[model samples]
Target: MKLALSALGLAVLTGCAAVSPQQGVDRANDEAAGFTQGALNLARTQQERDDRAQKTQTLLSAPVGQKEAVQLALANSAALQALLAQGWVDAAGAAQLGRVANPVFSFERMSSGGSLDLGRALSFGLLDLLTLPARQGIATRRIEEAQLRLTGDVVDQVTAVRQAWVRAVAAQQTASYAQQVYQSAEAGAELARRMRAAGNFNRIDRAREQSFYADAATRLATARHQATASREELVRLLGLDEAQAGALRLPERLPDLPKQALEPQAVASLATRARLDIRLAQSALDSASKAQGLGVVTSFTDIELTGRRNTAFDADGTRSNARGWEIAVALPIFDWGGMQRAAMNGRTLAAANQLEATVRAAGSSLRQSYSAYRTSYDIARHYRDEVVPLRKLISDENQLRYNGMLIGVFELLADARDQVGTVLAALDAQQQFWLADAALQASVVGRPGGATVASPAAAPAESASAGH
Candidate 1:
């Protein structure tokens, strides 16, 4: 009886929503519709944003040269926004002055044998007079460092936006190629089906062709999804929303790699001088070095200034404000400066050691960047010169052979597939190389600084559309 009931339950569930043609198609269509609606909404927002972006883009017309990818990134990037917020802190701090709280006041009265006597006094001494200048100097230096660090952050964030923009373009191109290949495969599959109907092709050929067409279609859809994802990523990086980022344009090609001498030392120095992290560290080190003097001078030493007022009771018990000043200094009889000096010296040395280590690490990173830059630049060059040309030749040859009847239709199709694969590979190689080049610049010059300093000689053509 239990087994029969279980079988009935399974039947009811399966009858309603079994994973069959109708159910699967319905689900797929629903998901596709959801994605389509989302995209349409995003497009609508984009149109609105484009209006504002156009004005901003106009200001950058000369620099970006109508490059949509760069225009979008410059308009949208959040990395830059973060840096800008951080910069506000520096700007605010620069105008700020450090001030100590005012001294406290208190009064007390006591009853004596003859009459109640009141006490009153005034005093102002906690941190010594010598320390204020030193402290203020420290604060002022910190402000300078903050400003420098802010500048570095701006440079780094701008570079990151540029990098994201370039990647979006590469991903767009890749997806576009996939789309074309899928369309061609679909056409070929349709032709093969017609041939099979006429009895010129067997069932096996039709099935294989159909499979190829399906595979290409799947790949194309996947590519489209990824391209959209990449674009979204670019929008987020640029600090745009669905509304603000929608109107941004991206360039079809990446910015050209600058041709300059890649010196390890020079690059490392730039990082040390410009990177926000290094500057922040340097400020910490400076603060620590100055703090050492406090411990040695403060041990068992009481430096105080005092003012007192006392009233005298005579025959009539008269009251008067009699004030006097007194100063006292402690004698460091026990500990002396031994332990304090030792501690201060230790901290000072530790901070110095850390600064040295950081400098060395920055240098090593620069060297690594140099190596990667050279390797990627070489590979990118090879792909453009050799791999791309060879793929084109093979594709042309296959077309000619098919026309001359030197190869079967199947062979021609195979060659076309191979050519597509090779071209895609070449494109990937090119993107990788350029990305590495950008990374190399990031390592040495700081991201934002690199973009500013390594401006491309002439911007690439702004020929890309939202859809290929």
Candidate 2:
């Protein structure tokens, strides 16, 4: 009786030792502090919800930059909330593996020939108590895996918000430039039409001006739509309500490029530090190895123990009492648990190989992400320092010549169009750099954001041809 009571008490204590959902959430936030900026939260109560809503509202009232956008999404996004909730569920389920099943209770009463019999039994799985330590070790590893996964997920979400903000702001700047191009084309076409009416311009020149005006109009429309689409994408990422969306404002332009790009040596050092991917893989391998060992004994057989008490009363005023226990063990005659052992062995092997693969690929992924980031930064800097300035200088010279009557109005208008095209291309280069920067930030922390470096010259070349 003392032994049985002791085991039951131990099981109850083990059950109480599992981590609570709040603790899991707090752990994830701490581990992902770089991405979350210590702002990750789950609003479980009305007061929390209201506080989060107020924070989001305060952020939305400003021209949301990259960091503000991430903050807004953390506070407002329903998808992010669902992700945290699922993380809590996974952690709780993993903790359950460490707890023993509740003991079963049975009762019976029988009457025959003026005699009554009463019986009671309490039964539980004995192997579960024996394997408690091993199971708890596996549960601890699984919980660690859950926390790392949540951290990686938060990094991914924040990277997405950063990239979307870049796109939204860049699109707005591009659209504003497109409007300038349209106005320049409109003026050139109008002047050409008046000159042709006065027999001062040729039909071919007038037609060319009109065609350029039409093309500019089309480009303007496309740019406007692109701006709208990018803004809406940011709005969705932020999980804003209709009212909040209506109130949302974005920065006027993308941030300027950093004075110096990230150093390769610095990137290498950061990549070598503890990464979420490597930790997760190691945790998985540990769990599989633990579980494999645990299955060796459990798969072959199981044992159950039951304690019982019985009392009987006879019609002749005679009574009897009995107290004892029962033991049940499963036999491995027809099934030797061979298949179960094989499955466990296979899982361990797979986990080992997966960890190796993750370790091997980590450096290469970081290098590729850094390459894209550095290349984008260089191209954007070139445009800002060389291309845009040269175009502006030419525009100024043309304006001076036009004022001195050394160039016609048509030549001055053409120069203006070329300068606007160059500026638009510069805007695109800046946008790509910001996107790549966001991706590199994620990759440094072991989550890749898939941003790539695009050709910085493509837009400007196309623009030059269109102007001609």
Candidate 3:
């Protein structure tokens, strides 16, 4: 009896202690910061929320870099906050499931012929108390799964914010060049019109120049809209209010490509170490296995232990007290829980299969993301080292020729326009490289976030002589 009472005391102590979700959230935030170089947090109080808002305001007060953009999104995004809050709730619920149910109490009173009786009883689920340890293990696994999921989600969100900032800044850069191209086209068209009036240019030639101007105008309009759209997309991701949006700014261009690309072996190693999806699957499998074992006993039978006491009075003024204990067990004579066991078996099998699938997919995803990262880096470098420089050389030569009266001004203007176009293409390549960089970082942490690299825009084919 002493041993049994000691065991019950231990179980009650284990079950009565409240579980906190903050620990899991803090672990996830720390892991995410290690992987993504950004911090994540849950603002559970008004003070925390206010502090985050202040930080966001400070970040938005200037031209935000890619890292700053990620920080801003982490601090300000309502959707991300909601996800964190939900994760906490899920973890708390899982903890609740690990605890034993509350004990039940009952009372009764009866009176007849000057006789009175009083009774009291207390009951609790014996099976739940006995299975508390196994249930707690399952709950722990569930909490671990939630933390990994939260880490993966933070990776995804930070990657998205980084990529969006890249596109927005790149769009703005492209739009500026497009405006330059438009101005050059307008000047060339005006010159051709003047030359046509002076009978120095043919009607066909002037029409061609006018056509180029029209195309340039249309391109400029498209570029402007693209810039606005991409900027708004970033704004939404950062969860900026109207006042914050007004203060938000971005760098004029994407950052330069890194000197060296990430080695595939290193990336693969990191993916293997930090793959949250695989960890989550493993947790699920473990939980399923434990639950399956627990179901074997629980599904077939349930036991409730009750302690009772009563007092009775007779009409002759004699009183008596009675004390006893009752045990209630669900009889499994009719149903043997065969279907429940089968379901548990099926769940275990599914969990095992899912774990295998996640493990297999992790390698493939990492490889694909690395490939995109390397390819985009190469393309962007090529544009920076070869294409833009070549265009610049051609433009410089054309300018010299025009100064020496060996080339027409129209030729110089057209060369300048083509140079701007080439720079625009290079800007686009840089953007793709940065985006791929962000995606690869996410993939390394086991959350593959981006798809394919964007193709570079084609340069204009018509030379300056075509308008002549």
The residue-by-residue lDDT of candidate 2 on 142-259, one tens digit each, is 9888878987888888888989999999999888888988898898899989999999888877887788798889888999999999999999999998999999988787877888
What is the per-residue lDDT of model 3 for residues 265-284, given as tens digits with 9 covering 90 to 100?
77766665757788889988
Candidate 3 residues lying further than 4 Å off, grouped into runs, are 1-12, 15-18, 35-38, 269-274, 333-335, 460-464
Instruction: Give one clash count per candidate, in the order shown.
Output: 16, 0, 0
TM-score of every model versus the real structure: 0.67, 0.95, 0.92
Candidate 2 accuracy as TM-score = 0.95
In angstroms, give how far residue 283 of model 1 lies from its true place. 3.9
lDDT of each structure? 0.56, 0.85, 0.83
User: Could you tell me the lDDT of residue 267 within candidate 1?
Assistant: 56
Candidate numbers, best TM-score first, in rank order: 2, 3, 1
Error of 2 at 335 (Å): 2.9
lDDT of 1 by residue, 16-125 (tens): 21122122223222322311121111112567457645655563343332134344443444454345455555544542323322333446677767766666654444
RMSD of 2: 2.3
Evaluated against the true structure, the overall lDDT of model 1 is: 0.56
lDDT of 1 at 103: 35
Residue-level error in angstroms, candidate 1, position 245: 1.5
- Let me know the TM-score candidate 3 reaches against the reference structure: 0.92
